[model samples]
Target: MSTEAEYVRIDDGVLEITLSTAAKGTSLDFAGVAAGTAALAELGADIGAVLLTGAGPNFCAGGDIRDFAAAQDRSAHLYQLADTLHIFVRALDSAPVPVVAAVHGWAAGAGMSLVCAADIAVGGPGTRLRPAYPGVGLSPDGGMSWTLPRLVGAAKAREILLTDAVLDAAEAQRLGILARLTENDEAVLDNARALARTLARGPRASYTSIRALLSRSATATLGEQLDAERDAIGAAAGSPTGREGVDAFLAKRAPDYSGLN
Candidate 1:
């Protein structure tokens, strides 16, 4: 784990993934992205949930423009980078456990896409989000086009991309981009972690099944969705954990779920 990019630490059931380079507003570059991906992969097996947040005042300020300028062929380089980013985003979206983004300050460009990829997002009252691609004469990449439309609808996504306007945390929450907003960054991260802890303690298999069903609902027909739901429910009901939960309820005792005797 390089000190340049913050390393992820898994404790109990939660994976705390913090962004380094806070002094630079936690700017995202190739190094940061690589580090993040590695951390997620390393912590995936042990951690039941992930809490993504920045270290300092800002969450992330998009890409490192200096690194971009140094690329020999900007177009080709960017395309390759975009492909890597897509892999990372899709992994986050489809993770067995949930990933929560805790946004404190600026979340722009790729940073905003990262937030959108999370299963849930929380932001501080003063957090700012923006689609800043057009401002730099570059088109959107890094799953922004796919995620923004799904999050805020095509019309609003178009407006934000075309105008590149800044939106506060409350506005983002109202628009459904953020699940909740807190008074400050610390509070935002704490609340997100609390939620993650709760989710981590719940029925893990059922949670993953629900996530898969909902994620595919947009493309699946109503009948297909119904069938999927039925299948998922049946599977959950047959699991030992679910059976234990039911038995515990009937017995008026707490369910033992520590995966140990």
Candidate 2:
């Protein structure tokens, strides 16, 4: 709704969410975080997947230092900003529809956190992800600490967080921070969109169930995870999409998943 972010319902159930700040640095202030949160919350029932990207040169440069300095009550100002960003990050995790981040140039601080929150990330050749918090005499926020450790292991995540390590596209990909890489920014977004479209057409219940299991894996014990997986798989098997897939296989025909939710 604001220039901070643009929300578009691209046909075929894909929601294209792009950071829209025109600033050269492209850092998000409090308003931008709130705007993004609102945009994500507005995803309708018709929407089946989301593709997140950036406008112009860089993806995002993290918090706008200028905005922070200009605030009269810096502490309260930051509290509000972080709170809003936290909500957006939580929404990304709980979203029924899967999300993909199409990242290029820079994804710093909260920007990098957003990428980490996505179900998948596609990075462009020029992508460089880093955390700007340590450089600013602050610590990581927006779930960066939690996401990165799970992503690249605790030792590497500690090095990244404490040392302001910059992860180039290749390194990020190798570390599993990026799901795929493209030759350029356009290709990055294009690939992400294609992935989103495919996900949109997939069995909704199965996709959501898989996401739910993964979300709980970190805290769940082996037995707990096994139980969760068993339940999820059983539910999926009973779903219309699952039945249709079985019937299609038996008939030697393409499954009509269009009948699924």
Candidate 3:
């Protein structure tokens, strides 16, 4: 059997997902969702965070143009491709744990969308991002249109999508597209993994609730946001882990989250 497009391995509390075919620009294939979805399904509730990174120099160069030409009917093939890709996007969005992206090289097209969807992203000095869609006479997909505007505002998102502008890591950081830059020479994957490890020891339920709150905030009205926060916090307060967190704080000790050492 051919190797899967991605590989997932959990060590400690971090689920590390690496794009195995970096030479192919980490372009996600039609079947890529199966491996990724299966991996997320295997993550027990106790797991802390999911870390995503490409295997080689470039992050993901987007879909394969050659493959696009190979498809006998481009319209139907693209629809099928997007359908599979949406599953991966939904998995990331609905995952109880936070997703940390380590972006390097070129995060083009859908690859850039993956970065935008991340809860936190760490990039390096050499990292570069481009919206490679317009160049091919295609439009954005993989939730890029939705998430990019939220990060960089509507006008800037339009610029990035419409023009063939390339955003360097520093520029991406300034625009709030990248959370922050690793050291000039630091390995982005290592930095992201370290961050995820720290998060892995945090209170799981609270983190999950935090993601849910953030997700809803994108579309919720002010009153709705407040209500969601109220209900979520209330539920968390009644959880065993939440009670232990409170007790630990009052007792003047570290909060020993459910699986924390």
Cα deviation of 68 in candidate 3 (Å)? Answer: 0.8
Which segments of candidate 1 are over 4 A away from where they belong? 1-5, 42-45, 252-255
Question: TM-score of predicted model 1?
Answer: 0.90
**Backbone clashes, each candidate:** 0, 0, 0
By lDDT, the best candidate is 3
Residue 160 in model 3: lDDT: 88
lDDT of 3 by residue, 1-261 (tens): 545534667788888776435556567544445677778877786578998777666777788888988999999989988877888889999999989988877788888988998999899999999988999999998899999999999999998898968999989999998997988635787888899998898887888889989888988999999999999889888888889999998999998885532
Supply the global lDDT for candidate 2.
Answer: 0.82
Please give the lDDT score at residue 233 for candidate 1.
Answer: 85
Distance from true location, Cα of 46 in model 2, Å: 1.5
With a 3 Å backbone cut-off (N, CA, C), the pairs that clash in candidate 2 are none
Model 2: per-residue Cα lDDT over 175-202, one tens digit each: 9999999977668777888999998887
lDDT of each: 0.78, 0.82, 0.83
